[model samples]
Target: ELKVEQNPLFLSMQEGKNYTIYCNYSTTSDRLYWYRQDPGKSLESLFVLLSNGAVKQEGRLMASLDTKARLSTLHITAAVHDLSATYFCAVDINNTDKLIFGTGTRLQVFP
Candidate 1:
């Protein structure tokens, strides 16, 4: 069975501060998987990892993965209220279409 775990399930930080969210998976996965969701909103793709050591950044958010370690990280720099949302990482099961998502990390950014 494939499983994904996210660290710091809940985070509350002041605006301008920085933080990181981690995702660890139990097995090898074939593609990219990062998403965000605001309250009552649909999920949004935030990052896509095509291979080990892949990294992507947009605005104040950055994401990277280490396939060898089965670990991925989403880092927030100088956070703002707009960045507050639930973040998730998912993995394909044995190169199949089946996916398993991590327990989301709900972040709250206050000014």
Candidate 2:
């Protein structure tokens, strides 16, 4: 079966604090994508990991993939209130033009 899972579904982070979000998959895949969303807003693409050890970063967020272990991670550095949002990781299983997303991680950054 193909599945994706994210731990710590809800997160409350303090300003200047750092944290990492973990994502695990149950099947082989060719690509993975990371995205961010604000309340009532559409998702914004953050990273795309296409191969083993692939990584992408933007600002305070970094995302990586390890295809061998079917794992991916998103790390946040020095979080800020402005970074409060929900993050999602999706996997393109079967390379069939479809993406199955893991349960989202909602983060609240406070001062």
Candidate 3:
């Protein structure tokens, strides 16, 4: 068996920025997967590309993309810790209509 953990979400950034979205999975699998989510958008797949060298993304989680290179990396490894939380937006009805932050995480693990 392989140790596993789940965390939320993804982000887009320019240069001189850090990546907070962490990835974790077994290191001995024959295949791997990497996913991300953008604001105002749905889940997106960073995998499944066509050629090599051509790439995409907006954050420090950057890498080359080319199917020919078989180098279309999936980046399946833990970043820092084994757990993470993605905070969301919420309305604080008690603070005179103040705004607060919340976390809603959904983990999908296959056994």
Candidate 4:
């Protein structure tokens, strides 16, 4: 089986609201990463979790990783129209630089 899983394939939020996304993996990995993609835009790196209990944040988004449980989370503090996009998390396996990505989380932030 592939290594990663993410819930709520789609989400919609009102402006100024908040939500959280979950990611789970099946195997041990060297790192986990979060990325965002806006319409017609390339993927933008959000967070890189290198170790257990790693957490990183930028703007209104925060990401955390727990290797013991093989899980990761992305929390959105407040929703905005500009934040409407797709979010993805990936796992970096031990033998390869390639990442196994979640199906994707499509978010719509209504203004």
Model 3 Cα lDDT, one tens digit per residue, 34-85: 4444445554544332233544443323433433322233232223221122
Each candidate: what lDDT?
Answer: 0.90, 0.92, 0.33, 0.91
What shift in Å separates residue 90 of candidate 3 from its native position after superposition?
28
| Candidate 2 residue lDDT tens string, 1-111 | 788999779999899999999999999986999989999999999998999999888899999999999999999999989888999999998788799999999999988
* Regions of candidate 4 where Cα sits further than 4 Å from its true position: none
Worst ten-residue run, lDDT, model 4? 1-10
Clashes of each: 0, 0, 3, 0
TM-score of each: 0.95, 0.96, 0.30, 0.94
Candidate number with greatest TM-score:
2
Q: Please list the residue runs of candidate 1 whose C-alpha ends up more than 4 Å from where it truly belongs after superposition.
A: none
- RMSD (Å) per prediction: 1.0, 0.8, 16.1, 1.1
Which ten contiguous residues of candidate 2 have the minimum total lDDT? 93-102
Kindly provide the TM-score of model 1 when superposed on the true structure, using C-alpha atoms: 0.95
Candidate 4 has an lDDT of 0.91
lDDT of 1 at 61: 94
Name the TM-score of candidate 2. 0.96
